[model samples]
Target: MMRSILERASHWLALVCRVIAGVALIAMLGVTIVDVATRYLDRLSDGAVAVTLLGSVELVSYLMLCSLLAAMAANVEKSQVVVEAFSHGLSPGFKHRLQGVYLLGFAALGLILCLGLVDSAAAAARHGEVTQDLRLPMGPIYTTAAVLSLLLGVRALIHALLGALFGAEGEVSHGE
Candidate 1:
């Protein structure tokens, strides 16, 4: 029952990350489209109007940052790049245990990243940092990144325990 709950929590975190990534991607696309369309508004309106997204680059930067960071949690298991050259003849159970250990290492790395991001966020908040073009406060962005990094760490840990310790991959994935 406990494993099931953790599995569900991991799954939900991934789902939420996916949604955040999608929204960030869409917002970036929208910003790009608007920037392009309004690039020559002064000429298009024959000097009657001058419109352009002044800080579009900065806006897109934050959006892309959020999208990439948000996707990290969801891609923990699916995006593991491995050679697997020496493990050709390994037993299924051994492979499961090996994967679990590898995931633990990933979790540790994620946690380290989370800690660094938290420090960075705190510094950004303390110093009143702002983006160059937009003049937007960076504390919120850094805070969001720190939170997502923590989520990646936790999801990786949960995936390691439930997916490998229980038996196989399907133990953590009962419905989807």
Candidate 2:
């Protein structure tokens, strides 16, 4: 029962990430449009257009990075990376053991990244950093991204372990 719930949750989370990615793409498009409009307005006004364009650039760049992260996380969940060399002539047991090792290493790396990002974000927040023009606070975004990355990394490790233990290559569905 718990396994089923985890599987379902993973699927739902992937779907949500896909949706957010799509929305972020749309927002980036909108930002481009706004930048264009502001350029035209700049010809009439003194320099208000420059400010708006800069703000849009900053906001859109950050959003697009977030979207890319979402999509990349989904790819990791799907096990979409190529592992061609390891595919040849390995026994089932060996393959499973190798996968387990890879997952544990990856989990450790992800934990380190999560900790570093959290520390960086906290330091930035303490300094009261703000983006130019928009003056947007980046603390929340940094923290959220770090947390999500951590969660996704942990999930990936768990799924990899589960598959290595009880699942065959064809039997496990990695949110495909």
What is candidate 2's lDDT per residue for 78-144, written digit by digit as tens?
5545375855677665665566556666567657777887987898799987777688777877886
lDDT per model, in order? 0.79, 0.67
Once fitted onto the true fold, the runs of candidate 1 whose alpha carbons sit more than 4 angstroms away are 40-48, 82-84, 170-176
Write candidate 1's Cα lDDT for 1-176 as tens digits: 87678767877888999999999999999999999888777678886877888999989988998898889887776655545786778876666666667888878987898888888888988999988988888888888888888878888888788657774543433321
- The clash numbers for all candidates, in the given order, read 0, 0
Off by over 4 Å in 2: 40-52, 91-97, 168-176
Best by TM-score: 1
Which candidate should be chosen as best, given lDDT against the real structure?
1
How do all models score by TM-score?
Answer: 0.87, 0.74
Q: Each model's RMSD to truth, in Å? A: 2.7, 3.7
Tell how far residue 35 is off in model 2, in angstroms.
1.4
Q: Considering summed lDDT, which 10 consecutive residues are worst modelled in model 1? A: 167-176
